[model samples]
Target: MGESFPMKSGDDSHSYSKNSLYQKLASDTVKEMIQESVIKYLDTDKVTSSMGSTTIALADFGCSIGPNTFLAVQNLIQPLQTKNLEFQVFFNDHFSNDFNTLLTSLPPERPYHAAAVGGSFYGRLFPRNSLTIAYSSQSLHWLSKPPQGVNNEAGIHGSGAPEPVARAYSAQFEADLGCFLDARAEEIVSGGLMFLVMPATPDGLTQTELSALFDFYGYSLMDLADKGVVEKSRIEEFNLPIHIPRLGEMREVIEKNGCFRIERMELTNPKSKVAGPLDAANVVTHMRSAMEGVFAAHFGASVADQMFDNVVPMTPRIADCFKALHHISNQLFVVLTRK
Candidate 1:
């Protein structure tokens, strides 16, 4: 009786109603790396002096729920707080995000403010050179637009497979990267630092790999739909667009924008060493939220639920996916300093 997992919004933006599994894992890994990167990038003198006198303005773009946002800010501020910097924090996300949920996550004693700005990050959201630091995690690969030629109506399935699909998506990714960089350049202070972490393929942006992942899941969902266990209509209306940019491609965008220089880039894959298989499945489930809409659209709501149920039972396969992903490609961590 419940609506399908991938609910369609009034706006064209697709919603994967559940929290992303991959995002949770990636957040833990990236947040650690970002903490280290920011410490290294901040000016030593400012780092020392700001301990007492400076009012540091920090913003987390695409900050969702505020738990991770708070965690990231805490990581950045804890070290600097000892030096006397007065921290003023801001959380940014789509207008649709639950500001109440985000606010409840904040510590009662924390010195911060919240802004609910509903719009894509195609331009500056803050006054020119207002923020001292900016952070984004697991969010950048989501382009404001779908790939140039790929039609969402067609579904991400078909005979040719992922190659054609990824190519179309990558083109749009390149465009969005430019817009993101340009906007950040205008909003961040000259010496501010920006840390971005997202799912990226080291071999560069390949539509084939992306498409293959989608196909695998697409079939998996269809398998469930065939069972008559889930609704078909819900899946038909859902679609998700995700694009992972290559390091070189990102570099070009940053260079062209002339707002920031790369300070550090690292590729890492983190997997649970915990013994249970469900933990791994949960990780995959988290990752799926970002892509669930696509499956929902192609298979329909009934099929999507069935697919999720089916996948939930396959612990070994879940472990294999995580292990294979770890062995194959590393997630990216990048630190950029404003010019």
Candidate 2:
């Protein structure tokens, strides 16, 4: 397993808490599915009876600093609340994550007792069969670490990466996702429900629009390299620690793990009317919030800041690349039952 890399922290303009509307939109697209799945598949009676406890434990794995996590937790607990059960909600992520921001920004009238668990979700974070529900949104795509010894000189993601690099990413995701499933299997009670939402494709292939975005990002970084602002070797050495899994790949992993039975799964567009278009500015902000940590780690923070700052003025030139992405269905939503 690799180490944990968290999203950008704090409440600043570029912070994940402020710029994670993209993830929030993805979460919203599956809100109804989560609620309905809980109602139909979650055996609350069985969990309470088996544990002999009314306090239902729920966990949000990879929950970054957020208002989004708060919304997701509420949705998952809403159905259980009708049963008059007490709730313990665990907000989990990397130890470096901004738990202070998450804890302080929590809804004042929230119904459950909340605690922060610091660590990677690719491993167990709770005692065996202690959770009644497990949820992760826009998070699982991130690998425990970038694939070792893969030279992805083309782009940061698998979109335009070389064959070896792409395979490495896919293989790492398969293993990391396996670890995640195995851990969640031990954590969730029998008949418990797990909901996941993340950026994924039909065949684990990179979408054309996403490829274009990656290319644009590559262009921006190479331009910096040309200006001697950052090393070309560093650019080539850097690959984003994320993998968008194919539906078939996900199915294979779930079945192979033999711990959770797939209840429902679907691919959908995360586009939203309220969220507006996938314009250049929106893309830049979302990428910065999500990737700044990775970038800052590879390059210095000052260099990362300079690179993103330079991209802002060039948005007019790159606006075309980010357009038309709204028509693509790139979000994967899944519901699982702990067997």
Candidate 3:
């Protein structure tokens, strides 16, 4: 997974920078929900002794750039600070993620000792029985690579695809997630917790708002191809290396993997909409920050730039496309415990 699916290269110009858009809009809800989960699931002394130690091991698997990672770590450890627990916090991401930015911006007063492990979450990055709590958010839907030769140029939703393409994506996710569970099962202590927050896809493999964003995203690139901004073949070959799954699919992966039991599963309300203009701009910057580097890496820098250039004028239309996405909920939050 690390070799195949590294994030778009980590550079400030072509990189995922610390953006206020995501910090203000995306992080708070996750912080609150994850905190609530910690309050309920983090039985410090018992969990600590479950591993025969008073040191609590916690990690954020896809710790993206900036204050959100800072915010999330703070939220997780601050609550535990009142309790008697020493912590070894590991911030893990692909080698391409901006760890320098993350380490530099650590809270002036951190609650726990922090370190970073650079690798993909789909493989082993920690030793056996090492971690007590692990969390991943707004990630996990990304497959290790795009479905080989599978095309969904007309629509972004896998449900809308024909048999072969849909099957390919599904199989890819199953394999990636299976690796994720198997790896974590080896790393986490018995009865440890993993809190996952993923974008919710609607049931029956149909298109949801989350997928529709890709719809518009793909369309813009395809349009650029028409205008000769990018080679049509490049657009044809490109597929977002991401998929959002229904809750059942996620749960099934966990059950089939045979290492963890589901403790809680939740689908939160649709993503909150800010005012129209800010919502539109925020929408563009948010998507660009997370995806631009990846797109550049997969496609070329010039083609990806042309694609996003086509995307800007269409930004406001994102509002309507987003409104069209009335899926199960905004984000899905799930809690899993080692069995």
In terms of lDDT, the best-performing candidate is: 2
Candidate 3 per-residue lDDT over residues 200-303, each given as its tens digit: 66455466555656667777777876887777776666666777777788778889998988878877753553433236556666667677766787677787
Residue pairs clashing in model 3 are 159-205, 209-325
After superposing candidate 1, which stretches have Cα over 4 Å from the reference? 1-24, 44-53, 111-116, 151-162, 204-213, 224-239, 272-280, 288-304, 313-315
Number of the top TM-score candidate: 2
Instruction: Give the TM-scores of the predictions, in the order they appear.
Output: 0.76, 0.94, 0.89
Model 3 stretches astray by more than 4 angstroms: 2-15, 151-159, 273-278, 326-328
Across 250-271, the per-residue lDDT of candidate 2 in tens digits comes to: 8888888899889998888877
Backbone Cα, N, C clashes tallied per candidate: 18, 1, 2
Displacement of the residue 311 alpha carbon in candidate 2, Å: 2.6
lDDT of 1 at 329: 48
lDDT of 1 by residue, 163-264 (tens): 666567666777777888888888877768888887666664343234444545556655655766544444454444566666676766677777789898
- Model 1 residue-pair collision total: 18
Deviation in angstroms for 141 in model 3?
1.3
1 versus 2: better lDDT goes to: 2
